[model samples]
Every structure is written in structure tokens, then in C-alpha cells.
Target: MNDHVEKMKLNTKKFASIGIMGLLGLVVIFGSVYTVEEGHIGIVKRFNEAKSQVNPGLHFKVPFVDSVESIEVRTRKNEEKMSSSTKEQMPVTVHVSVNWTVDKSSALDLFRQYGGLTQFEQRILDPRFRSATKDVIPRFEAEQLIQDRATSIQLIENNLIEEMKSFPVVVDNIQIENIILPPKYIQSIETKQTEKNLAAAEEHKLERQRLEALREVNTADAKAQGIVKVAEAEANAIRLKGEAEAAAIAAKAKALKDNPLIVTLTEAQNWNGQLPQTVLGESGMPILDLRNKQN
Candidate 1:
């Protein structure tokens, strides 16, 4: 009897322990709070009224008194409409993208008003974006809009930056990927561009040819100038040399005229005093008779 009673007591204790554990599990699952992770914002709500937000890390709230809502604070994306701009009946499509991230500083305040970051997109973001796009895009013709994609995107970004400052959304970038024009317009643009390109190429080729011709003419002129300079130097040198030679000859003639030996020899040759192929010497010089020619 004692052993049976002891076994019953042990089983009861075990069942009680399991029931307590089950109750604790249910309380933890239903009543406790959890943290929203990094890159996430937690929105707190009480009786469907938004209270505040928490950024990352662990946080706690009253058990079963408040509920937590989580939302991504990172950038989001969507495919936007690219409606035609002007009444010119020109239909063009522009593929654009937007990059936006939640503002960490304003997360708590944003969550109180918006409930979650995604709510910002539905209530605040979409409305502002549509209004801004309608105002800005229709201001230009389709042709003008296609050409200035960057400018248009900039205007949209500025508008977003101004309006989204109140919310947690921060605009990082806005881009236009492509401009899709009507087939007829596309064909016209392509043809015009081709003609312009051809004209540019021909102009470039002609300029190159002209430059080459000019270079050749310049080279020929330089060579001709070099040859003329060399020829002039040679002519000057020859003229100076000729003048020097003439001066030398005049000096030699003057020296010979001043000598007595040349004059005496001329007189002796002209003498009617006879000259012979062979003559006898009188003193130390040869003497000839003048009357020998009459014999």
C-alpha cells in the first residue's frame, strides 16, 4: 500500500510540472514582445492607435497591452508609368526607377503616424509621386522630355526630397533607363542621326586631307629655302676668292715693272747693235756690231 501511494504521488508531481511548463509557453507566445531586426523598424500600436517605433535591437512592452509591427527601412522599388507629355499626340514611354530608404532619425515619429514604413508608400509616397509627376512631365513635349531624361529625373528627385522629408523615406536616386518613342519617330530620329554622322565623317576626312596637303607644301618650301641659302653662301665665297686672285695678279705686275733687269733686257733686244745666235764676249758681257746687217 505504501509503495502504490508513493508512485501515485510521483506521477502527480510530474504532471503538475508539465502543466506549469505548458502554461509558461503559452504566456511567452501570446503576451511578450520582440525586437525588429537591423534594417527594420518596429511600429507600436495600442487599440489600433499608433504609438511609436523602435530601430533594431531588443525592446519590451506591456504584456498583451500593446502589439508590435515590423517594417523594412531599406530601399524599395516599383515600375512607374511613363505617360505622354504634350497634346502633339506624340506617345512616348520612359522607363524610370526610384531608390528610396527609410530615415532612421524619423523612424519613431514616422511609425506613430504611418503605422509602418510600407504605409508611407501607400499613403504618403504614391500620392505625392503621382501629383508631382503629373505636374512636371506634362509641362514638356514628348520630344523635349526624351532628350532631357536626366533633367526630368532631377526635378522629380527634388520634389520627392522636399515632400518625403517629413516621412522616413529618403530618396537616394531617380533614373530614366530608356525612352521608348513611337516607331515612326524612332525611324526618323535614326535616319537624321545617320546623316549627321556621315556628314561629320566626311568633314573630318576633308580636314585631314587639307592638313596633309598643307604639311607637304610647307616641307617643300622649307627645302627650297635651305637650297637657296646654301647656293648664296657658295656664290659669295667664290666672288671673294676671285677678287683676292685679281688683287694678287696686280701686285705681281707692279713689282715686275719696278725692276731694272726687265727694262734693260727689253732695250737690248731692240738694239740695232747686231744680235747673233752666238756672240763673242768683250768684257764679261757679249758685244755685237750694228753694221753687220748691211753686208
Candidate 2:
């Protein structure tokens, strides 16, 4: 019975050792494996110190001595609403948006220097963005900022890119979404624009009236010229008719002086053979005078 009890206890110890070894082996296998999701990079650290970096895939490390951290390598956005002043000391609120991404090649260095993504943004990006914005905002006036918003945004972006040159970040783009100015200033601008439009319209009306008056004067001058031309034509016609009538009368008088017998011959040819019924003289006779006279 004693021998059987000792054998049973030995088997129990072996079973317990096997179970514990199996449990430890399972823990080691599970702990050695890690997966880095797509668009992320993994950093392996040993004893709180960064040792190596890995890409997105299944990777293995020392079971209990090493750990991995995954950082996002995708594009990210940070938007900030900041109050700043223009060149003329006008207070304005600007909404700025920055599109950025991590430089994958420098991911390890980034982690080493800044610890993590959050720390990098807080320590480097946010402060630099604010500084760049403040520096650029004061260079433009309120009216300039409103009228030339694209130039202002470009200046800000350039400042920011220069500021982040030494950091491990890629600034894809920067946008100035909105600029809020004073209410009174906006109202004054609108009123000025309205007045300018009214002035332009009035000027257009005056120009139209001037053109209309000029056209009427031209028409009156044309009509006057036409009347003068018609009067001159009528006078010319009357002169020509009088000259023609005078020419015909002179021709008839010349013919009569040139030949006196023409009239007697024409009269004898027209006379019929007849005698007078009564005479005024004592002797009953008819007298004829056929002579041409000139004055």
C-alpha cells in the first residue's frame, strides 16, 4: 500500500509539471507573435528602449523581453481656430486646417525623439502651427487678408513648412477655411460698394443722355442742310426757265427785223378775196401797212 501511494504521488507531480510547462509554452508562443495593421508601422522595444522597427505584417519578438508599438502612417488632419491680429491691429478669428502625415522612413527616429504621435503633435506640430500663423497674420492687413485670402494662406503654409523642416512630418496642404472680421467693418465695406455701384449707374445714365442729345443735334443739322439744298435747286430751276423764255423772245424779234416781207407774205397767204362793206374815208378804199419797227 505504501509503494502504491508513493507511485501515485510521483504521477501527480509529473502531471502537474507537464501542465505548467504546457501553459508556459502556450504563453511564450502567444506573446512572441504580433500583427501590425495596414498603414501602420511597428516599433519593437526591449526593456523600455526602442530596438527595431517593423512593417505591416506578422512579426515575432522575444516572448517576455520585447514589446511592440504600432503607429499610424496614414494621413491625418489637425484643425485649429486661433485669434490673431492683422497689420492694422484688427482682431480676427481664423480657422486653419493642416493636412499632415508621418514620414514612414523616419518613424523610428520620430518615436525615439517624441515618444509617440500624440506627443509629437503636442510638442512640435501644434506649437509650430500657432507660431507660424501668428507670424504670418501680422504681415497682412484686414482688407488684404479678405481680398487676397489665397496669398495669405500660401504665406502661412510656407511659414509652417519652414518651421517643420526639421521634424518628421509631411505637410500635404494648409487651408484657411474662414476669416471673421468685425461687423462694423463689413457693413461699411458693403455700404461703400453700394455707393460705388450707384455712382456707376448714374454716370451711365448721364452718358446715355449726352449721346441722345448729340444724336438729335446731328439730325437737326442734316435736315437743315437738306432744306438748303432743296431751296437752291428751286432757285436754279426758276433761273433756267427765265433764261429760256428770254432767249426765245430775242430769237423771234431778230427774225422779224431780218425779213419784213415774211410777215406780208404770211398775211396775204392767210387773206381771202373780199371787199369792205363800209369805209370811213370819202373815197371807199382799204389801206394796208406792212412795215417792221424796232425800238
CA lDDT of each prediction against the hidden true structure: 0.76, 0.91
Q: Per-prediction count of colliding residue pairs?
A: 1, 0
| Model 1 segments more than 4 A misplaced | 1-21, 24-26, 86-89, 134-148, 253-295
Query: Against the hidden true structure, what lDDT does model 1 obtain?
Result: 0.76
The collision pairs in model 2 are: none
- After best superposition, candidate 1 residue 158: deviation in angstroms? 2.0
RMSD of each: 7.0, 7.5
Alpha-carbon shift of residue 23 in model 2 (angstroms): 2.3
Candidate 2, residues 28-135: lDDT per residue as tens digits? 999999999999999999998998889999999998899999889999998889999999999999999999999999999999998999999998999998888888
Worst 10 residues of 1 by lDDT: 286-295
